[model samples]
Target: MVKGVILRQFHSLILLLFMLDTFANSTDIQPLRQLRPRLVHLYNWAQRTPDYNVIWDLCCDHGLLGLHLHQATTAYGTHVHLVDQVEPIVDKLQTQYAHRQDGNLSICLTPAEHIRLAKQAKQLFIIAGVGGETVASIIQSILPAIQALPPSPHQQIDMLISPNKHVFSLRRALQAMPFTLIEEEFVSDKGRHHEHMFLRYQPAAPTPPSEVGDALWLPATQDKRIYIDKLIKHYGALSQYSPTAFNQQALAAYQALKHKLFGE
Candidate 1:
C-alpha cells in the first residue's frame, strides 16, 4: 500500500480507541481501577485505536492494567495481555483475576512467550519501570521475530515502551530500524519527569530510517520549548558536578539542541 494509505489505516485504530462503547463505571480492579486514567490514556496511544485497543503491563509491580482490563468492558474487548519475568507476579496475577474468570485477559510468564500469543490480537506492548536501554533491547530482539511470521492482512503490533532513561539511545535504535513515531511526550507524572514515545510497527511498509546526525534535536512546541531549554541548561550545568559527566558527547548534544531550538 501507499504511504498515505498506510498512515490512514494505522491512525484509524487510534480514532477507534476513543469511539469505543463505554462500560459505565466498569473498571473496578483493586489498586488498578485507581490508576485507570493513566493506564487507559497510555493504552489509547499505544493501540492508536479509538475503538478496540490492546494493552500489556510488562514491568508491573502487580497486574494493574490487567485488572482494569478484566473489570472494564471496553478494556476487556481490547484484548489485554500481561507479561512478566517474575514467577510470583504472574502467579498473583492469575490468582487475582481467577475469581472473575474473564476469558478476555491472558497472563504470560515471559515477554517472548507473550509475543507469540499476542500475535493474533491487535497488540500494544507496554514495558515500563526499566531503563531505556533495556526497553530498546527488547524492541530490537522482536524485530526479527515479527519479520519471521507470515503476513496476515489484518494483524499488526501496536506498542508503547516507556523506559526511565537511555531514551536517547532508544531513539537512535528506532531511527536505525523500521518504525514510525506516532506521538511522543515528556510529562511530569506525579511530579516526576518522564519521556514517553508512542509508535506503531507494521509489516506493510518500512519506516524511513533516521540518523542523529552528530547532534540530537528537541522541538519547540509551546510549553515544550521551555522544558527543552531547561534540559539543555541542565546538561550544560552538569559540567560543574563532574568533569567526566561533562564530555564532548553531552556538550555536543546540548549545543546542537540549543542551536536548533533557540538559534543560539
Candidate 2:
C-alpha cells in the first residue's frame, strides 16, 4: 500500500510540472492582446502619417505604446522614443528592454516640454491619457522649441493627442494653433468616450472648428449617440451647479448636438 501511494504522488508531481511547462511555453507563443481601442486608433493614425524618422510617445507611463510602435515599425527604420517625467518608471522600462539588441528603442526620463527633437527629422508626437488642460500646457511649452528648428525636407512635426476630459477646451486650443488638422475621430472604449486628432504644424490656414469635426455628428453608431448623451448630461449637471456663462454656453452647445444627432 505504501509503495502504491508513493507512485501515485510521484505521478501527480510530474503532471503538475508538465502543466507549468505548458503554460510557460504558451505565454511565449501567444501574442499580446489587442491594445485598447484608443491606443489602437493612435497607433493606426501614426502609421498612416507621411514617413516619420522618429515617433515620440510622450507621457508614456509603462512605455507600452512605444513598445508596441517599436515592434510594429522597427523594420521601417523608425526610432521610438518613450519619454516620462518619472525616473523610476523610466528606469524600470530601461531595465525591461535592456535585452533588446535593436537600436530602435529609447527610454528617456524627461518632461514632454523638454524632450530633444531630432533636427530635420520627420517626427510624430503622441500625447494621451491625460486631461485636456494639461495636454494643452505640454504642447504650448514644446511648440517654441519645435518652431525653432531649421527647416528641412522632413521638418514637419505631427502631434496626436487624446484628452480624458475637457475635450472642448482642448479642441479650441488646437484650432487656435498653427497646426492643420489632418484627421479627427471620436472613439469609445469600454463606455468611455475619447477624441483624438492628428495635427501637423503647417502655417497659412484659417482656424479649424472649435468642436470635434463635423464627422462626429455624421456617424450613426449607437456608441456615438451614447457619447453625445454623456456629454449632454455632464454639461447639464455643471450648468445646474455653476450657472455661469461658460457652463450655460457649453450646455447649450451639447444640447444642440444631441438634437442634431438624435432629432430630439
Candidate 3:
C-alpha cells in the first residue's frame, strides 16, 4: 500500500510538471491556431463587428475563445468577460490569468443569465457550443435586464451564436425577441453542421428573426444544400413520429425552403 501510494504520488507529480510545461509552451503559440475551426470562424465573425466596449463570452469552457478575444481586442480597449457556471473552470481561469494586472480580462463564476455589462458600453455576446434550446433560455432570461439598459447610437448589442442542436427552435425564440438578423453563415466542420448568426437588438425594427434564415439559403453552397436536406429529413421524421404542430410546421418550412432554393 505504501509503495502504491508513492507510485501514485510520483505519477501525479509528473502530470503536474507536464501540464505546466504544456501551458508554458502554449503561451507562445498563436491563440487562434489553437482553436477548432468553428471557433476560428466565430473569431473571424467577431472581428467584423463594429467597435464595442465589452464582449461577454458565455459558457466559456476553458476560456480559449475569450482569451483569444482579449488578446486581439486589448489594443482597442475592449474588455473581455469570460463567464461559466462551473466553479473549477472559473477558479482555474482566474488563477491562470491572475498574473496579468490588466483590467481588460475578467473571469466570472456565474450563469449566462446573470451576466451584467456596462450600460453605456456597446457589448457583444458570444454563446456557442451548446444546444439551441439552452441558448434560447439564456437569451430569454437576459432580455429583460438588457432591455432596461440605456440605449446609445453606438451601444447596439450584438450576439454571435452557434447552436449545436435544435437550431430551428433557437431561430423561433429569436423571432419573438427584439433582435433582427444581421448576418448568418452555414458552416460544416468535422462532419457537423452549425448555423452561426450575427444578430443585433433593435427595439424599433419591424422585422424579426426568421424561423428559417434567408441568406443562408439563397447562396446554397453544397454544404448548405446538404444541411437543408438533413434538416428536412430530421423535421420530417419528427413530424411523422411526434406530429406536433411545431414539428409539422418546421418540416413544411424546410421542405418549402428547399423547393424554393433548388426547385426540388
Name the lDDT of candidate 1.
0.60
lDDT at 193 for candidate 1?
A: 49
Candidate 3 segments whose C-alpha is farther than 4 A from its true place? 1-33
Q: For each candidate in the order shown, give its overall lDDT on alpha carbons.
A: 0.60, 0.81, 0.85
Q: Each candidate's TM vs. the true structure?
A: 0.67, 0.84, 0.84
Q: Which residue runs of candidate 2 sit more than 4 Å off their true CA positions?
A: 1-33, 206-209
lDDT-based ranking: 3, 2, 1
Candidate 1 structure, TM-score to reference: 0.67
lDDT of 3 by residue, 65-146 (tens): 8888888887798888999898998998887766542798888898876777687778999999989998999888878888
lDDT at position 121, candidate 1 = 49
Question: Model 3: what TM-score?
Answer: 0.84
lDDT of 1 by residue, 1-264 (tens): 699998998899877765553333233433444663445556556434633445666766577755555455454376666778789988987776665545667677886533663454465667776787788788777677766656665556656766665555566677766677666655555534456666677444656223222211244544545555665665566655665633345556756765776777
Report how far residue 8 has shifted in candidate 3, in Å.
Answer: 36
